[model samples]
Structure formats: C-alpha cells, structure tokens
Target: MMCETSDGDPGTDGGAAEAGADTGGDDVDEAGLAQFSALLEDSTEDLYDNAPCGYLSTLMDGRIAKVNSTLLDWLGYTGTQLVGRKRFSDLLTVGGKLYHETHFAPLLAMQGQVSGIALELKCADGSRLPVLVTSVVKTGSDGQPLLVRTTLFEAGDRRAYESELLRARKEAERARADAEAARKTAETERARLHQVVVILQKSLLPPELPQVPGLQAAAYYHPASTDQLGGDFYDLFALGDGSWSFFLGDVCGKGPEAASVTSLIRYTLRAACLHADGPAEALDMLNTALYARYTGNDPRYCTVVAGTLTPRDGTFDITVASGGHPPALLLRADGTTDFVRTPGGMLVGITSRPDFITSTTTLAPGDTLLLYTDGLTEARTTAGPRYSEEALHAFAHSLAPAGARQTVTALTGLLEGFGNGLDDDTALLALGVPAADGVGVT
Candidate 1:
C-alpha cells in the first residue's frame, strides 16, 4: 500500500484495497495538501522581501515597478517612493548615470541579460554606494517584453581598499622624490666647500705679478688637484729704481700651514730687500726669520731662488741667490742654451745658519731666462723613466732664443705630453727682453 504526501507524489499508497483499508483515506490526504500549499505561499512572499541581495523590476516604459526591502533600505526609500516614482537611473551616481545611458542600457537591451557589473548608486543622503548589479529582461508568454529585473550586491569594501592602495603608492613616490632632492642638495654643499678652499688658497698668492719694465715676464702654477691647496708660488714685483725682484719657491707640504709659510716667505723677502741690495742679504734675512719662527718639532723648510734684475749700461744685470733650488737656464739669441749653476746653497729653515750662494749674469737684448720647481723635471715617462735635469736642459737648448711666453707655453705642452704621469704641481717663471725697438729677429 502506497500513501500520498502533500505535493501529490505517492509516498505510501492511500487506498489499501488489497488489505481492505480504503475508508476515510481520500478526505485526509486532501486536507493535508491544502495546508502545505498555504505554507509554500507564505515562504515565497518572505523570500521576495528579505533576499540576501537587492532586487528591482522596471516596466516596459523603464519606470520602477517593484523593489525589495534590502535595496530600498540601501537607497533610503519606501515601496511607494520607488514604485512608479523613480527609474533605476535615478538611483545612479553621476558617473554611473553616464555609463548607464552610453553603455549599460544599450548592452542590456541587446544581450537581454547583463550580469555582475560594477556601479555606484546614489543614496537619499547624497552619498555614493558601490555595488555590483546584474539585470535581465522579463517577457510575457506572448513573447512581449514586460519588465527588467536586476540584482545588486554591495561593493563598498573593495572600492575602499583599492582607493587606499592608490593613496599609499602616491605617498611613497613623493618620499622618494624628496630623498633624491636632498642628495643633490648635499652634493651642492660639498661643491661650495671646495670653492671656499680654492679661494683661500688664491689669497696666499699674488693676484698678478707686476709688469717689470723692459722685461717679458710670464709664470704658471699647476695645482696638484682642484680640491687640495699646494705650496708652490712665484712672483715678480718692482724693487724701486729700474730693478725687479722675483722668486720661485715650494714649501715643505700642501695645505693651510704650507700656504702660511708661502705668504711669510713672500712678505719677508720684500721687507728684507727694503734694507739690502745683494741677493745674499735678502735670503739671509728670510732664513733667519723662518728658523726663528718654526720650532724643530714639526719643522718647516722651503727651497727658494731669489733674484734681482736692473737695467744697466746697454745690458741688463742679473743676480741670483739660491737655497737648495735648481739652477737657472739661459737661452742666448743665437739658439744656444746653458745652465747657470749655483749648487752650494743649503736648504733654508733647516739650521740657524745654513749656507747660501749667489751668482751674477748679464743679459743682452735677445736672451731669455727660465726658472722652475722640481715638479716639472721629476715626472715619470712612459717607460718609467724619470726626466733628468740634463734632459730638461737639452730640451730648453733645442728651443733657445724663446721669450717668457713661448718658453712657459712650450713647457706646459711638454708636461701635458707626459699624459697621466704628471703627478705633481709645477711652477714656472721666465723672463726675456722683447724685440728691441722693432728690430725683428724674424
């Protein structure tokens, strides 16, 4: 025997004729089915009002016909406010309204079903709510379009997360830019410090050597590095009444202390010559001052050559006082060169009474004299060869009869020719008579 359940599929047979049990079975089954149908109707109405997502329906004219409680609550509206009063586009944000008009409505009409698209809805409080919507066309049995149904899901959390990430990335980029700007500012400060040091170094030397009458004079000072101050200097200044005083010297080391010593030597030489005529007397005064001022603990010394020139009776008279410096070069008008040696002088500031030497020469109209520090002649060559003094003398001999400008220019070119081997600061001073009274040698 089979009896029927409420939905009309037989569970157990109601009629038990085989066992003689057919009485009162039909009436009981009918009553139970009526109760089941009423329960199903109530559940359907509850599902329509309190669905997990939102629901909406529009008439054929695109007017709102129905909306669920969930959607109405999000929009801050009642059933009367939505139905027949507002369309789906009225709930969109400005951007959402543009998208609905240009793309969403056309796409829904063509495809008949559009699913799971992002949008923003305008709430009654004038705030925007992010959502995902799916819409489909509804049709009657006669194949006539009657309404459109749409589902909505809240997407506020996802939109907020994406916005926060963009803000963080923008902040990180600004921090990186600020760091780069600070690095460049630090570099700029370093350059300014270096420039200050360079200016201080220049103050230790003469701005320009005075122009000695009837003499072609030129000089050069090559710094070991732009960042470091060296102690090499030379100057040519007038010593009253037709004679000029000049010097070339290098102090013991580089930096501020050496620059101090350099300035001391220059001023001391000038002051000493105010009371003397001979080269030996001037250098003697410099040596005594240096030895007295510098203690032996961190002793300071310098190699120097002090010379004077005076125009006398058809030729120029020249005198030199040497203190452990190289000999001078004389280039004659007839292309001959020789070293005027003064080799017996002791290094200045070494002892209280170190020996000094003096030499004398006469320069005719077309002669040149060259003086230099040790940096030029001591550089290494390509084959690891030190440029000997003999080689330099020979090089000058080959370019004899050249005046001050030409001589220093040629030497600068030679130093450059050594390429990477010029490892020290070079100082040069040269003097010669220009072509006398337009008597051209060429």
Candidate 2:
C-alpha cells in the first residue's frame, strides 16, 4: 500500500519514503529504521538479562563465559567478578561441586543434556540457595561442542515441603512403636497376674482328697473365670480320731477377700470338729468364731455343710450339719434318691448367736452321698432357667447306684455343658461305700 500526503499527492518525496518504509522498499526512512533496530536490540538483551529464571553460559571446561544479570543478581556478583574469572563448579557449595564433577559432568558429557539436577549454590554472604538446574551442550554447525547453556530454578519451597513430609513420617513410625510396646507390656502383666490367681486359688482348696479306708471319696471344683479367685471351697481331712471331718462351702462373694474367709472357714471347721461333741456343735463353734471375728457393717458370711464320717460295721454313720446351705443328696443302690434335709439352719457369721441344724444318714454299701455349694443349683442352663435344687435331685436320681467317682465325673460333665451359662464357682464332694463285690469306682 502506498501512502498519500495530507494534500492527497501520491508523488511527494516524504509520502513516497513513508510508503516505501512500510512496504520494505529501497526508499525507506533511515531514522525510523534506526529507531526500530535499537528497540529490538534492547528488548532481546533485556529478556536475557532479567529472565524469571537464572541463565549462564560456560565454556566446555566449565569456566564462566557469559552470565545473565538475573543469575549475577542472585549470587550478589558483578559481571566482572565472575565472567572469565570463575568456573561453574566454583559457584557451587563444596558438596555440590563434588557432585557436579563426579555425576553431573559425566552424565551431561555422555547425554549432551541433563535436566532437573538438584544442587546448592554458595551465595556471597555465606548462605545457600537450593536450586534445580538443567544444562545443555550448545554445539556448532559442524557438531563440535561450543558452550553449555544452563538454567536454574530456586527450590527452597520444595525442599521445605520434603523435610516436613519426612518429619511427619518419622513421628508416625515412633508413635506406632510406642503403642506396640505398651500393648505387649499390658499382655505380659495380665499373664503374670493370671498365674498368681491360679496359685492362690489352688491354695484355697484341698490338694487331693485323702483315701478313706472303706469309703470312696471324689471331689470337683470349677471356676467361672481363669483370672479371678473363686469363693467356693472343699476339704476332706482326718480328725485324727476314728472319724473324718469334711466340709463344702461358699463365701458371700468372690476374690481375695472371699478367699480369706474361705481359708478361715476351712481352718476353723477343722479345729471345731475335733473339739466339739457332734456335727451340730462343730457348726455352732464355727458360727461363734465367725461372728466374733467379723462384726462390722461389712460382714462376711458363708453357707456351709460340714460333717463327720465315722465308719461302723459294714457302713458309715454320716452326721451332717447345715448352716444356710443346700441339703445333701443321697443316692442309693435301690434306684432311689432323697435329700437329707435340715430346714432351719441360719447363715453362719450373721449374728451373736446363730442356729445350725444336724441330719444323720447311714451310707451303706452301694450308697453315695453328694454335698455341693449353691453354685450348682443356681447355675444358668440351656433350658432358660436357673438350675434349681429340684433339677439336681432329678439328675441324681437318674444316676442311682453310681459310685462317688462316677457321680462326680457325671456332674463335672454337666457343669462343662453349661459353658457360658454357668457364671459362678462350683464345688462338689461325693462319698460312697463299696458294694459287696468291692466295686466302688474311685
């Protein structure tokens, strides 16, 4: 397009020159051309000097040849201080210099380029600048290396992020380790406590039933929990006279306090049976001892059936005393069962003077007498009700003619069958006379 002058003349020298310049012809304006060339030169130089990222050109041997103002400003250096005076590795920290020589230089020489190499640069003030750098070998047209062009981006934010992430991970690992140690410690303590409970529980009962000359005796004990102490206890020991003293009882509660009471009862009964005249008198003595010892608002009491077994001709005379305890079951060889009842016996240790009662029964050959704590009759059962005394009597009736050992074994099976339904401690003692053929099981 040709420009017309303001007076509409197309042939004027000034208008012709303006049109030639706009169209890139020979008659262009030298002043306008000079101004355009200057502006383009300044812009190109400004772009390189003040780029967002640092830029530098280094010789093949790493000596600094040219560096942009952006990079020089970052290092607080003048162009005269670095250009031709320093090498690329000299601008790096000591570790960074070693890495540049060993890893970066070798990789770049082989690959012709390296990207995203993280390094630290030494600042003029003895501080450090973390950077991610990339470099390329600028080659001549003949394929010979000329110089290395490098760009660097500051990496302080990224470094800070990585450090924070590492710290959090370490803390999480430490917390898990601490929790595992605590759990293991708790488990060890629990196991130790359980062992102590087992030992203490054994000390409360007879180690084994003694062998009575003519009578076959058997006993069983079951605890509701492995870790807790049970209140029920049984003991069969000699009176040192011609007779034997035996007792099965349950204290009012469970644990160490109840165990203490159980121990007291066993010892007190043994002593009382030896000195007192009969089973009833022995129970009365026990009541006196307990009442004298425990006399506060927090009174400890127990239900007990204690007895003396004195052997006679072809049989044993069993004189039993009850103190608020369940009646003993008598199973005979004649396929019959009965309860030796003492109806008005009071709970031992509740008053200054409490009443106890006596019941006498003869255990002939093929007769078994069973004494038990209330844990048996009060146990929960699959039938959806508490196993009452009536059920126990019926169960015993089914096992008539069974010996002491057989009876105890059967009842132990029954207790196990209750599983979680049986939540209380139980104690069982069975005494039987042999048949004519000496066929008592135990």
Candidate 3:
C-alpha cells in the first residue's frame, strides 16, 4: 500500500533534510563564535583587576581617574573611595609626596616617562609599603598630556638587605678605630719602659774616668741590649800615697739582680783598696765578701781583674790581680804585645776560698796596658768563630805605638763593627805612660 506523504515526495524530502542539516551547522558555528567572544571579554577584565602588580591612572591635574582592583586591595581601599576622590600623591607617605612633587613630577614632565623610582605608599591601617614605581604620560591626539599611567612593585626585601649592609659597614669601621687606639697605647707604654731602662743602665756605669798625671787614661762600656742593665763595671780612683787603684769586672747574668751584684762588687773593691795593701789583697777581700753574700740555692759568681799603679822615676809601676779573668794585654814601647799571665785563679763568689793571682809590670815611656772583659774576645765573627785572645794579640801588635785615647778609639771602632756578633757587655780600660818628649800621648 503506497502512502502519500503530507507535503513532498521521497526525493524532495531527502533534499529538504540535507538543507536543514546545513542550516543547523551554520547556527552552531555562530553560537560558538559568540560564546568565545564573550569569554575573551570576561578574561581581559578579570586579568586587569587581579594583575600581579598594582596600576593607577591620574588626570593631568593629578586627580585619580582610574585604579585597578589589585592596587585598591593592596592599599586596603575600595575603588570608589580612590577614583575621582583622591590624587595619586595623596596615597603616598609625606616624604614620598614631597619627592613626587619636587623630583618625580618634574622628571616625568620633562622626559614624558620615568621608570624604577623608589617610593613609599601609605595604607589605610597607617603602615607603609616600600615600592618601585614606573609611569608614562598618555598624550591626546593633539600631542597634549592627558593622563599618567603608573605601575608599582613591592621593594620590602631589597630595602631590608641595604639596611643590613649599612649596619655591617659601620660595625667594621668601629672595630678598626678601636684596634688603632689599642696599638697606640701599647707603643706609648713601650717608650716609657725604654726611658726607664736607659736611666737605670746609665746609673750602673762610671760617670767619668779619673785623670792621672803624666799618664793618659780612657775607658768604654757597651751593653748588649738597651732593655736591660748589663753586669760589667769599672772604676779608677786614687788610694793613697800617690798610688791609684782601678778594677774591671763582669758579674754573672743581667738585669736588676746582676746590677745589684755589680754595685756591691764596685763598692766592696773600692772599700777594700782603702784598707788592703796590694792588688791581690783587694781581690781576696772582694772574693770573701761575695762568697759570703751569695750562696745556697741561688749561687752568683763573677770574673774580675783589679790593679794598683804608682809613679816611679820617669815610669809607672803597676800590679794586676785576677780572679778567673782573662789576662791583660800590654803594648810595649817596642811595638810588641803580650798577655800578662795569671794562672790557677778561681772565680769569685763561688767558694769560701778562691785562689787569686797577681802580676806586676812596669809601664815605661810609650807603653800602654789594656784591661777588658770577655765580651770582646768571645764576640763571634761572620764565620761563627770567636774573636779569640790570639786575634786580639795580633791586633794590638799591629797598632803603631799609641796612647790610651787612640787605642780606645781603635778598639771602640772594632766593637762597633762587630754589630750583632757582640752579644755580651764589654768594659775597656786603657792606661798609658807618656813618652819622654810627649810625642804620642794625647
């Protein structure tokens, strides 16, 4: 049974169905495009409101024309409260406001744009926020400035870092100043101690050598270090009956204790010379005194050479005594040198009975006798060998017949040349008899 369709034949209905499908596809495309457009518009407005950085726009008169939701949220103010009701500078701190008027505004006017300006913004809660700002002036079609668009970023962390750096710098400067002051104080104290040492050492030495008639006398003393007193001592003084007494000695060790022993020895020798008959007797007395005073756990000792001189017919008779001391060097009128031997003598202040030895020599015209401590002979050379008595003998033998002053000067130069090699105190005493014509005695 063939049923007739209400409107069209089979072929016509097929064609209509195809047309309806095409129209439906067009409508779907249109609807999709409209929805996409609405979505794009919504996204643009949301992005502007919730941007990561704050944004604001101000009119040419500085009145706020527009502000993003992000900026309003950061400042704890609603958009309605800021736009058209306040200016951009009104939302800044007092100092920031002044800076905006004086520097930021003028620079923007001149340059039409300013970037990376540091400023502080005031919040509704009265707190401040450090921020870096950038702004550009938007011009109208006529090239006239209409509005200013600005962007801001928080600078709290950067500000904190700079403040810490400043604090560290100030602390370092204070430390350096304190260290310098301490160093200066130490130097001042050292200077004061040096002065005291100098005065003390000078007191331990003879002020001047005694003058002898018809004879020339000279002496020199050198200390190894200036910080402490040396133990070497010497003195020349008249005894009685035209006889003069002299002595050179070196006490053990150095500093205040050794200085005390030196003082005692000097006074004892001088006192002994007053009552003793000869050089040997004077030394014996000194040995007895020193041994009695220094004994027990802390034992002290010294080496000494004592002498007495008397003027004879056109010559001088001298007697020298030794207590464990080096032999005296005698420079003869014939330009020869010899050590006056004193054997088997013992050190003073070591035992109750120390053997002292005596030797006698006659100082004739152009004859000089030199007495010294071990500091000279024991001085080390560059080769690490000592300037022994043998070398000294050779030195004295080479000198042309000279008197006390000239001999002392030559020896002083020698000592100075020794430099750091001379590590001990040296005491020198030279006595010479004048020639008949007084040729070389000065």
Candidate 4:
C-alpha cells in the first residue's frame, strides 16, 4: 500500500526514482563547472609566474612582498630569499642603487608612476644585467599609497649598441682634431716660404737710386704676385769720370729661377758698363753674356733698355740703346712730348748675334726722359682691350710739364686704377733736368 495524500497519484515509486535522477544530473553539471574553474585558476597563476618579462611587488618601505618565478630566475635567487629578506633596490648594482634613491624614487613619489628607466641589476653570481624597468604605485580606495608593482625587460643588446655608438663618436672627435692640427702646420710653412721669397726678390733689385748732379730721378717697381718673386729689375749708378749709367729690364718667367737670372743680368750689366765706351756696346756685352750662359733647350731671354748720361755745361748728352724694349718718351719744357724711337732691335739673349739700336738726344734744361717695361702697355682695361702703346703715349703727353716725381706718382695712380688688369709686374724710371730759371719741370 503506497499511500496517497490529497490529490494523490498511484505511482509514488516511479516519481521518487525520477526525482533521484534529476539530482544526479545537477551534481554532474556542478562537477564540470568546478573542474573548469580550477583549470582557469591554474592557468592564471602559470601566466603570472613564468611571463616573458620579470615582475615583482614591494611594500611601501621597499621590502619585496611578492616575486614571480621569472624575476627570481633572472636574479638567480630563490623565492624565499627575495620575498622575505630582500628589497627591490637590493637587486640593482651600486650605481643603479644610487640612481634609484636619488632620482627614480623621488620622481616616482611625485608622479606616482615611472616608466622606461634604464638601470643595471646585480645577479647572485656577481654579474650585471642591463634592463629597462617600469613601476606603478598601487593605491587603496582612499587614495593612500599601498605597494609598488614593477616590470623589468632585458636590455643586453641595447647596452652593447650604446657603447659602440660612444666609441664611434670619440674616434670622430679625434679625427677632427688631427685635421685642424695639420691645417695649422701647413699655414705656418706657407708663411715661412713667403718670407723667404720676399727676401730673395729684394736682393735682385737695387738698394737705392744714384743721385746725378744735374738730374732729378725717380723709380718704382710693382710686383704682380705677393707670394712669388718677379723678373723685373732696375739700377742707376755712376760709371766714373762724369758719366752715369742706368738700365731697366724684364726677364721671361717668375720665381726662384727667374730671380737667379735677374741677379746675373743686373750684375753683368753693371760690370760691362765699367769697361764699355757707349750704351750700345754695353748692351752688346750683356747680350753676349746671357746668350753664353743659357745655351740649352730651355733658353732664357729678356728685353732691356740701357742708357748713359753726361752733363756738359748745364746740358746733358744722353745716348739710349734698346734691346726689344719699348721706346723712350721725351717731354720738353714747352709742354710737348715725343717718342725717341729705337726700332729694329732684337730681344737680348735669343741669338748669339743680336741687333740693338741706339738713339741720341740732348736733355736740355727742363727736359724729361721716361723708360718703362712692357707691363704698362700690355695691361688690360676694364673693356678687355690692352692699355696699348698709343694710350701710354697720350698719357705721357697729358703730363708734359710734370716733374719726375709728379709723373711717376700720376702713372702709379693709373696702374692702381687698372686693378687686376695689370697682370704682370711693372718697372719705371724717370729722369728730368731743372729749368734754368730754377723751376722744377718734367
């Protein structure tokens, strides 16, 4: 008799069996959920302990409260050793510890977070590990600081790269310093060589112009280049027995070789004048000497104008000779100018037998004679044409009544005006006789 209550059915045994089956199904479902929850917990713990980077948690006073397995492995310490006894800064090297205390801690205290701080850590085996660290301060609900959570990344390769960069920068600095030293040495040597060239160039020219009794004379020399010696030279000296001799010449090239030839020619001319009777003979002797000295394939030559002046009772007897040189200008006291031409003269030292022409004139009272090198005529104007011989003639005519000093001063100013157009060096010599009325006219 399975009893029935109010509104009862007659299958009580079957209903009880059904209720038991429902309870078993609920138990099975609950067991599956519990298994899944346990698995998820285990995975979360594994992820935190064995992550790619290091992790640690510290109390407010910096004592290590928790440490992951990965951090313990990098520092070569057991969890028990670090979690209970060590602080976070204890894993850093001496320098890193000092930096953390002075800068990193203060910055973190003010900002509540610090990231990407470069630091070096100390390992248990007495080695260093370069790392970049980031840290955040965990706060309670009331905004009170509670603990610090930190993450570290390995930076061995980055440290090596920075060291290499520093080495390269040092090498570049040394190279720059060496180059500057070499440049200064070169400049000093250049200055010394320039001084030597200047001394040699001065030796080739006359020390001073000789004073003639009845003549007022002036001379000037202009060098084209400041660094190298030039080939132009001039000299005026007494040749004994009421006779005065003067010569002006230009050689072919410049520098030490040209300077040597210039010296030889000047001395030869002075020696020849001591023995020769007239200007033409003296020039002939100079031509013979130069031709004999340079008889090789590289022949040396020059253009020369030699002259002699002899005072005769308030008037002077002047004989001029030309060796392929420009014609001399004669300026009269009456404000007229003419060229004392010596055509058909050959360049000296070109051939063993060269032709030289001679011209004679009496430098009466208030007369002037002017001689110059080809640099004056060959100079270029701003319009690109040469300052021709005709132009020089006209210029001399314009200064007809100028004295030697005045004429030279005016011509020098003209040369200055030419600027860079005067490419070659110039030599000028001017001689003038005073008027009988004590007037100084060219």
Candidate 1 per-residue lDDT, tens place, 54-86, comes to: 888888667998888888888898999889999
Query: lDDT values of the candidates?
Result: 0.80, 0.87, 0.85, 0.85
lDDT of 2 by residue, 1-442 (tens): 0111132433345654565567677665778765554544434456667887888888999999888888888888899999999999999999999999999999999999999999999988888989999999989999999989898888989999989999999999999999999999988998998899989989988899999998999999999888789889888888888799888888998888888998899889888988899878988998898988888877988999989999999799999889999999999988799999998999989887788888899999999999998888989998799999999999999898889999999999999999988788999999999888655665
The model with the greatest lDDT is 2
Residues forming the 10-long window of minimal summed lDDT in candidate 3:
1-10
| lDDT (tens digit, per residue) of candidate 3 on 139-215 | 88999998898888878888898788889888988989998999999888878877887787678777898788878
Candidate 2 accuracy as TM-score? 0.72
Off by over 4 Å in 1: 1-202, 378-395, 412-424, 435-442
Instruction: Give TM per candidate.
Output: 0.60, 0.72, 0.72, 0.77
Question: C-alpha displacement of 313 in model 4, angstroms?
Answer: 4.4
Model 3 scores a C-alpha lDDT of 0.85
- Stretches of model 2 off by over 4 angstroms after superposition: 1-120, 130-158, 184-188, 330-341, 376-401, 410-422, 436-442
Query: Which model, 1 or 4, shows the larger lDDT?
Result: 4
Clashes of each: 6, 0, 0, 0
In model 1, the clashing pairs are 1-13, 2-12, 2-13, 2-14, 3-12, 3-13
Which pairs clash inside model 3?
Answer: none
